[model samples]
Target: MNFNFLSPVSDSVLAHNELLSAQVLGRKLHIHSKQNGIPDLDGVSIAILGVLENRNDVNYIGEEFELNEIRKSFYALFPGSWNTIIADLGDINKGESVEDTYFALKETISVLVKKNIIPVILGGTQDLTYANYRAYDTLMPMVNLVNVDCKFDLGDSQKPIKNNSFVGKIILEEPYNLFNYATIGYQTYFNSQEEIDLMNKLYFEAYRLGQVSKDITIVEPVLRDANIVSVDLSSVKGAEVSLKQKYSPNGIDGKEICAIARYAGISNKVSSFGIYEYNPSKDDELTSMLVAQMIWYFVEGVNCRVKDDDFSNEDYYQKFITLVDEQELIFYKSLKTGRWWIEIPFLSEVNNKLKRHTLLPCMHQDYIDACNSNVPERWYKAFQKNCL
Candidate 1:
């Protein structure tokens, strides 16, 4: 019930040489600045907790990655109105139990909710989602949980909290009927026929990866009704969540994943959000960059959806037609970093006139780059000139 962060983490510990520094998009509230928490940002508060350890990946020195650089990565990804506050869980050993982590997260979430700010949990593992939900349980008797993961994560084995058993623990511990939970993007390799049978028996709503690819729009209704969203970065194919568990060479590309994140963020019912399993140790430069991009798109989705006016286009009511006529407007299929980009003319004026705020242009660039792969630059230039 009472809120406290694991005491004032010693200045030296919090301020290590590797802790990189980058300006966040919104107001920055260092926990040391105000113990009572920022009173003003009750509606939308942001917190980034680096739970950067696991039973399997124990050798990893969680803090080696510069915090400021990581922050900068986020800055480059999600550009606007981010009330950023960050903390690190350090290397939580097997002795350092999930319950304690849950306590810390609960206290933090309590404070943010009291102040009306949205709380985001960056994960150490998928198991953290259970801790997040446990924290949620302390506040409300019932809250919907949407798990966007590549696996069903429900196995009969009573193994230590590892890669695939997180959802199983939740379902068994907390009766499925009591909570509205849906599993999306479940791949074949992750689940067994028995597991699938159990899920069907339990009447759990599920969408396989093929189904997701068929039409991502159906995910809209699932998210729209959920109270909390747990997004496993592994669910995304190209994500750099784990070196050992990496799904690279094949996975959902960056852009669609961003769109999914955006939808979850804008889900009005979504009070809490989480992105898990970011094993930076295995990640390359591009991996963090992609994570950053996804974060940006999520924020943009929230901003766009929550804003009073629609800004899909500059004019509120224009001749609504797909303008990509003869000239193919080059845009990437997925917004990856270092992709080609064409300037969109009249963008500033349109944004200003429409009263729309676009966050993290880097993400937009990723989108532009991906789509433009097929489309020509000259067409883009012409489109830009016409729009201007």
Candidate 2:
């Protein structure tokens, strides 16, 4: 509860919210303000944290205040069937160094997540993802991260931490809690051959930008099994963001990224999410609105969550078994949501974290492929990672 690092929301932003109607989000939000102090989180399920730290970014390098633009748009929107309470925890300013900022963030994240209040962070740099990953160290024995980015971001682990190299640090760092790392919308040209080979060698998952664009729903299965979802705003096209400094020409479109955000929200396992690399100076009305909608969609998904983990209860799941290459594969389809999950056999001798949850979210096609004597790459990868 020691949120001393958090600064109160600006009077100007609060003034804007005052003008809105009672039905608007601005009125419903429990904002941390100078007059009212940090809002009570008795029933809040989601907290919006604006992180203003970017000294380590490799691109658009500068220090300035953020969150006003994004909050202006996010607060103006109308809520849609959401019963979950949201709090604007204001912003966490940069510290003496990047490590200091990380310490503040890690502590803040740990506090919110332990209370089961998911933190939807609007961040300074994508490298803050390293801090986000570290926040979950004591909360969960293992973690599954899904990053929506144009590049794999597996920069040299030996090098210092930067926007492009945070993922490498997470992989090589101590208390290796990262169980699985998946990259969605990675453009091949943006990543080097060495990093790509390393991703394969380590059994990490990477989905090409084309593969996601071709069938965006395929990402749902990947996200459904994830515990942490981090997005790099630079993955958005330059045209959509209306900023040339960080946006790329070829990447996830605005609508697709919002859809992915919703998918992440719907996952019962996903506890933390951050949209990083947002440049407030370069942002326009459209840019803020896009980010705001992504947040809205995520909140909506959280409200629609249903607990379908009890596969032992026959009434909730349709169990199916298939054989491929003389190996048996079991799949469970939720009768309520039609979501599919494959069973990874329990190994008592293996790490307890890997055995904590045996079900891995997968697609219907994976089961069909198994029936056709073809291995689902998704299952194969998880199997390899766990067995190793």
Candidate 3:
């Protein structure tokens, strides 16, 4: 538990916390403060951490930011009927270099993950996700990342990593822990044709902004299978956030983004969650409150989680088999939660990246599509990736 890199929460926020009702989250959380120091994480289920580094932002102009506003908004909200213990471990201030900040964040996340505690990261820039992804290098054999962003952020990995280009580094970097990467609510105009083709060529998943807005439920299965979930506040619609935080006129609305966060939290496989690219401004109250509610929904979803993925017992799930284009598709439905899963046939002969991901979380629509002799796009991509 070497959290030496972490700075305690500010005294002003603590003063604000003192005024909050005892029933609110601020009073209930195990907060790391100046007077109290770091709280013991013995029974903590989730830890809130903030990163104050933003040099990697392509638009960086030597500006500093803080998470106090977001913290204030979060603290004011009343908690739902929940049993999960949460800790506010405070912020990691910017180091001498951006890489130094990344090192510190990587170390902090690595320690938190190894303890089986989910780190709800409030980030300075989306590129911090690269550090978060790297934290999983030694912890797991393979990783699946789901980014809720408007752009793919697949910038040239050969150059310096920016907030928009970190994904490229994740894909090309060594240790090669990233097995799958998916983008939800991606706007096509923001991405180049080459990046779009590259995503398809790599057999990765990308759900369009329009498609996701039309049906947010489609993302449940994607999030369910993911190990790391990163959200860019810029993905939220311009009208839904503060002027400084707005990126696109068209994007996921506040409720939709929060729903996606809840889905990420409810997923049994999702180990680490991050909300990045927050640009605080003078009138960022709306944005701060939205971020706060998103966290609240995520914590709420975590409390509602059930062990419905265990397929060992016959009573827990029901299985179905169908044929499409001579390809046998097997589906499993959880009796406990009614969630669906489609099995990817393990290729014993090939060196597979998805050795542990044989059962792919799917939707009931996928089963219907399979029955109608159509292959689900997710299954096809995952199956192809497994073969490669």
Best by TM-score: 3
lDDT, model 3: 0.94
Give Cα-based local distance difference scores for all models: 0.54, 0.89, 0.94
TM-score of 1: 0.63
What lDDT is reached at residue 374 by model 1? 42
Worst 10 residues of 3 by lDDT: 348-357
Q: Per-residue CA lDDT of candidate 1, range 1-388, in tens?
A: 3433433322443344225445443223343222333233323345445444354322434442323334445543325664333333222222265566656766666665555556666656677776666666656665667888877777654776555677777766753323456787888777788888876655556778887877776576567557778877777775434464476445565766777788877665677777776655544556566666766666666665543223344333121112244533322211222222232333554422212222111123334444445433333323332332
RMSD of each: 13.6, 1.5, 0.9
lDDT of 2: 0.89
lDDT of 2 by residue, 257-348 (tens): 99999999999999999998887655478778889999999999999899986787899999999988887899999998999999887668
Candidate scoring better on lDDT of 2 and 3: 3
lDDT at residue 31 of model 1 (Cα atoms): 39
Candidate 3 lDDT over residue span 1-388, tens digit each: 6888999999999999898888899999999988889999999999999999999989999999999999999999999999999999999999999999999999999999888899999999999999999999889989999999999999999999999999999999998888899999999999999999999999999999989989999999999999999999999999999979988789999899999999998999888899999999999899999999999999998998989998999989999999999999999999999999999988888888755548999999999999999999999999888887
Candidate 3 local lDDT, residue 82: 97
Best by lDDT: 3
